[model samples]
Target: MPATAPSASSAALPTLLRLRDETFDPANPGAYNLYLLASPGRLCLAVADVERRKFVALEEYQLTTGGVPALAEQHDFLSLRGWNAVRLAVTGRAFTLLPSPLFRAGDELAALRLHHTPTPTETVRHTTHPGLELVNVFAADAALADWLTATYGATGRMLHHTSALLAGIVNQRGAASPRRLYLNPGPQELTLVVLGQHLEYCNVFACTTAEDVVYYTILVMQELGLDPEQDEVTVWGELMPDSAVFSLLRTYIRNVRFGFRPGNVQYSYRLNDVFEYRYFDLLSLHFA
Candidate 1:
């Protein structure tokens, strides 16, 4: 129940979701590995037993407001709650990828332009995963980057939300249906990833209603030559089973199912009480 900054900002937004283990001891920070995820509408942190690969604690706060302006403030407030050594991942939509061979460290913003037109003041950065054979190029506001570094001591592994989503999907690919569509929906944005032999397609769409969700999803299905009546579509992020988005998706796609936790990792029973699909990006940070 304790928080880092119980300011008017925290009071205004309120904590929308929270889950943690009774075994967690804030005093022994070094006993677990910490992961932090900051998004436009949510801020989250989790602790896991590195060796056992089990999540020990998890927390999420929903911002009444959205976008980069509120991230630093919410993050500073979350920091006061409790955390040890940490890994920070920013989950905004402004990110693109370049093959590792073509990536130039100082020109992340330029590389991002291959796909996006970043704002003038956005802080551009890149992280390479040699195994994935691609460098994730992303942008965040300068102030948010500075605050994260000052508080977490310079993040060595900066992940875009897509990186975690891909990692999670790849880890579960073996058990997944032969063809699948994975959707991670945020406040007013949805990230769609189509997986098969390789990543067939991946893109983010700005959406506001259940109708918009169905339109984009079906559009991608058509572009990929997928049959909505047969192909399975697994969803995660902001929507729930009974939510409008999920219901609408089910109406169009016959095999609509919620995603499961990363198949390759172990998790504590505490995490089982919540829907595994909810924090696929945050928990998958272990694999990223």
Candidate 2:
């Protein structure tokens, strides 16, 4: 007789547990969506639940030089299909993949392997999902990485700052839960995307300067077949907090009603309730 296949329900349960442990909200029933960020250099794992808009857990690693490279190598296995469920292993500076089953054990073990004791780097033994696709990956500039640490490294500091700013705007206009969203980042620019339900058109521009904002907003509106003079456009990101940038953008983009959505919007290994930060979450928001 052919070997019996593992029960789908059993396999799925582990996936669900991994998802929940890594990103779900036990306090909020029915919360499923999550984003995970892993950085081997820092030995940090940041997990955020998009539904509750909060970071559920965070842990750091203390690895020597030998372990750092070990974890960094696993970047090749990072893919979008897993969503927020992932396992990271690091030995010195080297990177390795962990079996997904380990993710189900809870964040404690995940934390231990990632941060505490050094373990032999083991090869991850599992079949890769056919649907998995590498979406967005980029190198963090040394200066930017340093800046992030200085500005938002403390526990709960970044999340609190982000939530307060965004909650105000999202609540003020009572926008219909943002039907469509997109996030794009270049070496020098980061773009936050919001789209209509049909996705007929999209806004893509850099967040660093006001001119780019106005140019992209107009481009998206025109593409969507909406006149900028008549429709409302809401700009969201860290740059929104800068009055000079905001003013310049508003002046150039005339007649259109504009608003600000504040918070840290970088795609990093940190979760913020206020500003959007996870790389996969940004990708999901756009494709969602």
Q: Lowest-lDDT window of 10 residues in candidate 2? A: 155-164
What does candidate 1's lDDT look like per residue over 1-288, in tens digits? Answer: 443334455455556655566666555565667877887766777778766677877777664554433544654334432344466778666888777898777888678887778787778888776656878898876666766666556433466878878887887777545867889887688889987766768788899999999999999999999899988888888787789888888888999888887776777677776888888888878777
TM-score of each: 0.84, 0.34
Listing every candidate in turn, what is its Cα RMSD in Å to the true structure after a full C-alpha superposition? 3.8, 17.8
Q: Which candidate is the best by TM-score?
A: 1
For candidate 2, write residues 141-200 as lDDT tens digits: 233233333422321111111112222333333335444333333223434444442222
* Model 1 lDDT, full chain set: 0.74
Superposed by TM-score, candidate 1 places the C-alpha of residue 276 at a distance from the truth, in angstroms, of: 1.9
Q: Kindly report which residue stretches of model 2 are placed more than 4 angstroms away from their true locations once superposed.
A: 1-45, 49-54, 57-84, 87-187, 190-194, 203-208, 252-288
lDDT of 2: 0.33
lDDT of each: 0.74, 0.33
Best of the candidates, lDDT: 1
